[model samples]
Target: MEKIATREAYGRALAALGEEQPALVVLDADLSKSTKTAIFQRKFPERFFNCGVAEQNMMGVAAGLAASGKIPFCSTFAVFATGRAFDQIRQSIAYPRLNVKIAASHAGITVGEDGASHQALEDLALMRALPGMTVLVPADAVETEKAVRAALEVDGPVYLRLGRAPVPVLHGPDFIFRLGEAVCLREGKDATIIATGIMVSQALEAAQMLADEGLDVRVLDMHTIKPLDVAAVVRAALETGAIVTAEEHSIIGGLGSAVAEALGEECPVPMKRVGIKDVFGESGRPEELLEKYGLTPYHLAEAVKEVLARKQAACR
Candidate 1:
C-alpha cells in the first residue's frame, strides 16, 4: 500500500502534458511549491508563470491565454481559486466556454493545520454550479495524474480538484481515465457505497469490513462531479436498493447530494451521507480530523450497516 500525494501526481502529469502539447501553459498564484507546479516550472520555465499571490489575476491571465489558443492551467488553493475568484471564473472562463483548466490543490478537509479558512469543503458545490464547467475529483494519486492529462484534452472550462493528504494508490499507472465517468470498484447486492476523492479508498476498506459482518457492500469511484455518473448511480440503486455516499466534501451539495439527486428521480431507496456534516474544520492532523469528522473506515462500515437496517425495516 504505497501512499502518494495527489499534488505530486498532478505536478508530474502537468510536466508530461506540457512536454507533449506546446499550447499548454501552467500558471501559479505564488504557490508553485504548495500546488506542486514547481516541477513544471523547472522543466518548462517558458511555459510556466508564477503570478504573485494574485489568484484573481492568475485566473484572468489564464482566460486570456486560453482565448489566444493556449491551453492554460491555473494552479492554486481550491478555496481561493474556486470561491474567491468565482466571478472571474464564471464570466471570463466558464461563461464563454474557454479551454482553461483550474488545477485546484489542497481541496476538502485534508488540508489540516491551516484551519477552516483554508479548507475547501464547499469547492465542489461552487464549481459545479458554474455553467459549462466540468468538475473532476480523483480518488488517489495515480488517478489524479490520469485526470490531469484527461482534463487537458477536454475542450471547455474544467475544474480539477486535488488534495494534500497522502492517499493509497489503489489503481495502477496504466489505469484509463474518462471525464464524466464513474467506475465500479467493488460489486455486491446488500448495499452500495458511492464515494469520491480520498473517500473512495476508505470506502473500499469499509466494504471489506462490512463483508466480515455478513453485509454486502458495493463501492463506486465517482471521480467526476459535474456530469455525474447518473447511469451507474441508477444501476446501483436498482441492484442494491440502498446507497451510502461518502466524500471529503460537504454533505449538502457534493457527491452525496449528487447521488441522492440521481436516485431520487429514478430509484429511490434508503440513503445516508458519510461526510462533513455542515461543520467547519479546525487545526489538527489530517487523520485526527478525519476521525473526528466520522470519515474513517469503521465509521463508513457502521453507516453501511445502519442504512441496510433502514432498508430492511422499511419493507416491514
Candidate 2:
C-alpha cells in the first residue's frame, strides 16, 4: 500500500483547485515547505502570500481576502493556527463567516519529535466551539484531497486538521466524500468502533484483529466532527449495542465528545473512548507516541471488548 501524509495531499489538492478556481489563494505563516503549501506557492506564485511567522496577521489577511471574494487557504502548524491566532480566526473569519479555509498541518500527537508545545491535541475542541465553523479530519491522503475540494466549495469558515506523518492509503479514487457524513468501513453487531483522523486506520486494524477472536465489531470513519453524523451514530448505538470512539486528538472535546453527546441525547449505550487522556504529548517517533498514548490497534481492540463487556453486563 502507498503511504503519504495528509499535509502533502492537501498541498497537491490546493494546487489542483487553484487551476480550477481563479479566486483561490494560498497563505503560509513562514513554514510553507513543512506545511506543504509550497506546492501551491510554486505553481501560483502571484496568489501565494508568505505571512512570515505571524499567524495573527495571516488570518486577518485571509479574512480580508475572503471579504473581497477571494478564497484564501491559510496554512500553518495546528498549534499555532488554533492557539496562537485563535482570536483572529474567531473575530475576523468565524464571526463574519467569511469564505476562508484554515488548513492546519502537523495536528495531534503525530507531530512526533516536536513535543507538546508543537503538537495540537486541543485544536478540534477550540475549532468546534466556534459558531458556524466546519471541522474536518481526514484519515488518509485520498480523503484529504477529497476534503480539501469539499472545503473549498463551502461558503463559510472551514478548519481542516491534517497530520504530519505518512499513513497507508485506505480508500481508492472512487471513494466519494460528503461533509458531515460518517463512512461505515466495516459492519458488525457485537460493537462499533467510531474513529477519526489517523485513528481511523487503527480502528480498522483493531476490527480485523477482533474478527480473528470471533468478535464482530463495526468500524466507522467519522471525518467531520462539528456537524457530526448523528443518524449514523444513533444507528451504531441502536444496532451494535456498544460503541468505542477513537481519535488522534484529546478525548476531551474531539470525536469522542461529539459521539458521546449525540448518543447521550438520542441513543444511549455502553461507550469507551480511546484518545489522549487530558495530558500533553512528548517528543518521540510517531509510532512510539501512538503506543505510549494508547492510540494503537491493540488498545482499540481491548476497548471494544471492554465496552462490549459493559453492554452485556447491562443487558443481564
Model 1: worst 10 consecutive residues (lDDT sum): 172-181
Residue lDDT tens for model 1, 71-134: 9999999999988898999989999999999999998888999999999998998888888889
Q: Please give, for residues 23-64, the per-residue lDDT of candidate 2 as tens digits.
A: 999999999999999999999999999999899999999999
Instruction: Name the lDDT value of residue 121 in candidate 1.
Output: 91
Which candidate should be chosen as best, given lDDT against the real structure? 2
User: In candidate 1, which residue pairs get closer than 3 Å at backbone N, Cα or C atoms, i.e. clash?
Assistant: none
The backbone clash count of each candidate, in order, is: 0, 0
